[model samples]
Target: MMKLREIAHSRTGDKGNISNISVIAYKQEDYETIKKSVTPEKVKAYFSGIVKGRIIVYQLPNLWALNIVMYEALGGGVTRSLSLDTHGKSLSSLLMDMEIEEEENEAN
Candidate 1:
């Protein structure tokens, strides 16, 4: 197994109670592995404790990235939330910690 960070990097953004995260592959060839391994269900489950609503994933093959939209994930938006990470900027870092199967070539 390999961590998502091994092949990709992520960026985070927010609006109201929603969190938008984009996972971009470091190499175009690895995009397929990321797409197959990182599903909306998996992302939802990963942040199950924090996100209270539905999740949506949009594929951008040309960009080699996945855009994940998480609803009700900011604990009621930045100004209203009591959490330190109300903006959820650190979410990208947290997501990179998720484990996934390594690419076939990397297993050798």
Candidate 2:
């Protein structure tokens, strides 16, 4: 197993109750591995406790990145949320911690 952070980095943004996170690969060659491993369903399950709505993933192959949009994830936005991370800035870190199966060659 390998953590997503081993080959990628992430950034996050928020609007209302929605959160947008971008997972970017350090090398274009690793983009396929990230794409194969990181699915919307997995992301939703990983954040099930915090995300109340649906999750959408957009693949940006040219940029070697994936855009993850999650709804109702902010506990009611920055103004209304009682959680410490109202803006959800720390979500990217949480996502980076997700473990994925390493490619066969990489595991060797």
Candidate 3:
């Protein structure tokens, strides 16, 4: 799971659901490394059951940063399929709290 540490938080226009979140490094000097940590597969695992949309990422030029946009992930596409759960927290923050589990598989 990805560790989602909250940086900035903003709610969508409806204010009923949907949110815009930005996250930075939880640990010092790990910005670049951390940014690289957020892979699509990791997002799947970190979000687990609550997520249901396309995740997009944009890398900032000349900076150790990545901007992620999770589309249609809020309220399960606004069709009553997604519940306003998650405890009213930024998804990025939620992701900040997760740590990717590393394995000991050796390279050939």
Candidate 1 vs. true structure, TM-score: 0.94
Per-residue alpha-carbon lDDT of candidate 1 for residues 48-78, written as tens digits (9 for 90 to 100): 9999999999999999999999999999999
Question: Distance (Å) between predicted and true CA of 89, model 3?
Answer: 4.1
Candidate 3 residue pairs in clash (backbone atoms < 3 Å): 2-98, 3-95, 3-96, 3-97, 3-98, 4-95, 4-96, 4-97, 5-96, 75-82
| Order of the predicted models by TM-score, top scorer first | 2, 1, 3
Give the CA lDDT, 0 to 100, for residue 69 in model 3.
Answer: 60
Q: Model 1: which residue pairs collide?
A: none
Global Cα RMSD, each model: 1.8, 1.8, 6.3
lDDT of 1: 0.94
Regarding lDDT, does 1 or 3 come out ahead?
1
| Lowest lDDT 10-residue stretch of candidate 3 | 7-16
Supply candidate 3's per-residue lDDT for 35: 60
Could you give candidate 3's per-residue lDDT for residues 1-108 as a string of tens digits? 323343222222222234344444544454555566666667666665655666666665444455666655566444454455532354554665666433233573
Q: Give each model's whole-structure lDDT.
A: 0.94, 0.95, 0.50
TM-score of each predicted structure versus truth: 0.94, 0.95, 0.56
The total number of steric clashes, by the backbone 3 Å criterion, in model 1 comes to: 0
